[model samples]
Target: MGKMLTVTTMFLIQMIITFETSGLYAMAPILSNNFGINHSSIILVNIGFALAGICAPFFGVASEKYGKKKFIIIGVSTFLIGSIITSYANGATLFLVGRSIIGLGYYNLSGLLLAYLGDIVAYSNRGKIYGIIRAASGIGILLSPLTSTYLISNFSLKVYYLIIAFITAIILLLSFFIPKVEKRSSYKISTVDIILIFRNRDGRLFLFLNFSMGTFLVLYFSYIAVHLEAFFNLSALNIGKVLTYSAFGTLSGIFIAGILSDRIGKLKLTKIYYLILIASIFLINIVNIHFIWIITFIMSLSFDGGWTIIQTISSEIIPEERGVFMSLVFFVVSLSLILFYIIGPVVYSYGGFLYTTVLSGFFIIISYILFLKFAKNNTEKFN
Candidate 1:
């Protein structure tokens, strides 16, 4: 019963985050025209939201020193407030403020969710269960863009955010059921520890891979719908449908990767995911409307599959310092946001979506090359 509740709550968190994020992207073109600004202005909102990720390492140490459930409650409470503030936003400044608050709360909840689950589930069964949760997140990927389009076109952004706010309230209630673990005597991310973490080769490899995957997905969410509208003359509804179809690809990957990670071993499965990522970006860019969905699905699959393995690997590394290690790993991933935000718009301005995908493919290729160059069999294993 408890495990079921925990999984259900984690899935809800995935849904709302997807809901807001997909909506922001889908709304970008529409909002740009309404505000008389370019796409950059609307996409810049992600920077405000991503700023909260900067504090993750501190939150990680704090979660260990304090308790996981306590912070989750605070996170949920903060998210609820942010949702209210966002719903009432009439201008970009106000919207940015609301999203910033949402980010603050959101990173807290999202950062801790998997760790909370790890505490309860046995190691042997963990990967499979994690896969199921990730696949469920695909439903959010499937619906949010479509939902955002229909709501914004027929009603208002105000109504849409309010609905998100209501759902957040329920999540706050669900937050209480997350079982608490006993706290350790002391937890600290010391200066030596920080330095050593960066010096660790596998840490660097996975971190680079994580960053590449994260930045690429950010670009996808920020641009794909707009690209369809701009290049293909796709209506909002058709763009949503396209995104929805691509999500099935992600669902297939997450479900398959989860089962395979456990069966084939994470390292073996990871290699396949990397190749798919590099290949998908190139293919996705070259394809026409008729073939875009196939490539997009393949691309989407690699992103989520790679992430699932990354999450599991982080949990396995430094079990005693799992919270700190996981947080630090994600902290590096967060840095990608600032870099991508600045560069994504410039890339799009130069040659449109095609340039963006090509640049992203280069990044993935670089990450893969670095891994092959530096990685050792023992690197991923705790040294």
Candidate 2:
């Protein structure tokens, strides 16, 4: 396939996956209603996505050993099947079982899309394209909450999932346009080599940053809908509107992060991004703002946008094994979510949501300091 066609194909497919992941938040109430459960318990559906994340490393390795094109096709197909099952599920356990299948597909699907980008783009332009592709994720982010809210409020949850499932079908058709990429048989690395990836010093930092950022982002999205409904007394429609506005901020953050990463050094820019993320979270937690909607919008932009920069840096950090590295990053992120999100509501139940938010930020601060101490730039050339 031609470069432009390939890029366009990848962008659209990634957006579908992104929508499925982020759109779940807007559908939380609907999922609860369908399953006859409460919102907090229904939040575990987000945990299913994270569980998929933990499996990314295995997918990363498989993509490298097999071919990216093949994995993308399989992953997308599996996601469609999973979504269909989940949509028809009559109970919470069956709903999660369906979600788990979709989740497993997500890891490979997301990892390969990124690794494919890493293969096509040169080092200098990688960050920019990564940002642009990431911005497409926001398109799905913008659509999911609003679309789900409208469908659920006006129609039904079953209809909403069916619509998204159809969209996923379109995404799968577009997957054909992506160029095929085969793993380097001679360059194949063992599980031991994967372990040695952590010994790279900077690799460890990259992994930790990936983990920390994942914790904060997932926690925010997982519960933001519930918070809006309970604390601010916003309806599903208004929540979608609020999320759409915040997505604009996130969109801007993504583009600017890419531009800045190219101009500034990746490391310096990432450090600054983390600081911005920390400050934004602090404001949300510490301030007693009555206009909670405005705060949520601003902070979502800062936090999500800043993390895009971190992701760009990560895509750069372990360039040789982009698929594997990204997989590990996704895995760590999923691990954190399963541990945090599964128990987070309990923490919120007793300690308050503010406590969990503050704790996530503190973890970011700690991880940032460690990354600053150990992470280093690559001297190896990529053209």
Candidate 3:
């Protein structure tokens, strides 16, 4: 019962954090208006978060040496503080600062939670368990936009932030309920340990694949809200409705992929998802406005599904070092966000959504080829 409570509490914490993160993207239009910034400038909020994520690998190592629960508590508390600041911010600089703080907490909690789960769950069932947990987190993504849109339209953007902060505070209390796990005996986690991760062929492949895949996924979500508003002339509520449909697809994909990953193996499933992802991106580019929701749904499914598989593969690669490995995975993801934020606006300005989508598809194709050439053999070794 205690174990179940611990798992449930952790899942809820993840769900709330996911909600907060997705809400920022969902409310991008309103935020731009509220702060008098352009869409391109607003993206810096996400970049700030990514910049803070540079600490994830180090935090991962710290979690192992010190303890996971302490870091989890610290993370949630930091996120709460950030949420409070963001809620009250009247200027762009303050908002970005708050977001950066949230980023620090976000990566810490997300990375350590996976490592903690890896400690408790058996290797055989880890994939399915990750899927379940990710699906739970996906609920936040599923509903955040819809809820944010409704709240922002009816009330104010500040209300959304306050609500998030309040809920996060509640979760902080629940986090204390988390059961303690046995810590590693060695308190020494040197730079060499992290460097050694890259020495493995699988590690290199996973980093490259995660970065490439993340480039597509992050760019799509970060700019899609703006695209719909600018290109299709959709209202904020309407855009949120569209994203809601995509969120459903994300949830379905994570759940299904989780089950399939355990059965078909992560590598094989990833390849299939990659093809679907390419098709979905291409279809979205050409599809009429009315049919875009369907295509976006497919795109979200493929992108997020493939991401779940790859994350599972990453965790399994160095099971003993799951914290550091997952943190590095997130680090690469953050790096991709940083790169895309710099270039995404330029791409959108020059070529618009079609060209941007094509560029993302190009990245995915390269990632698929890399997977086939390097990761296939090493990935199969574990599966």
**In lDDT terms, which candidate is top?**
3
> Which prediction has more favorable lDDT, 2 or 3?
3
- Pairs with steric clashes in candidate 1: none
Where is model 1 more than 4 Å wrong at Cα? 372-383
Per-residue CA lDDT of candidate 3, range 1-383, in tens? Answer: 88788778787888988888887777888888877878765786677888987898888888888889889999999999998888777778888888899999998988788888888888788888788778877899998988998987898767878999998898899888888888775866678877898898878888888888768866788888988898799999999999999899889889888888878877788888989998988888778898989998988888889888787777877776788898898888889888888888788778877877888888899889988775556665756
lDDT of 1 by residue, 144-207 (tens): 7788888988998789889999998998899899678776657666889878877876666766
TM per prediction:
0.93, 0.92, 0.96
Model 3 per-residue lDDT at 5: 82
Write down the lDDT that model 3 would get. 0.84
Model 2 is weakest, by summed lDDT over 10 consecutive residues, at 374-383
Clashing pairs in 3: none
Candidate structures ordered by lDDT, highest first:
3, 1, 2
Error of 3 at 331 (Å): 1.3
RMSD for each model, in Å, please? 2.2, 2.6, 1.6
The Cα error of candidate 3 at residue 103, in Å, is: 0.6
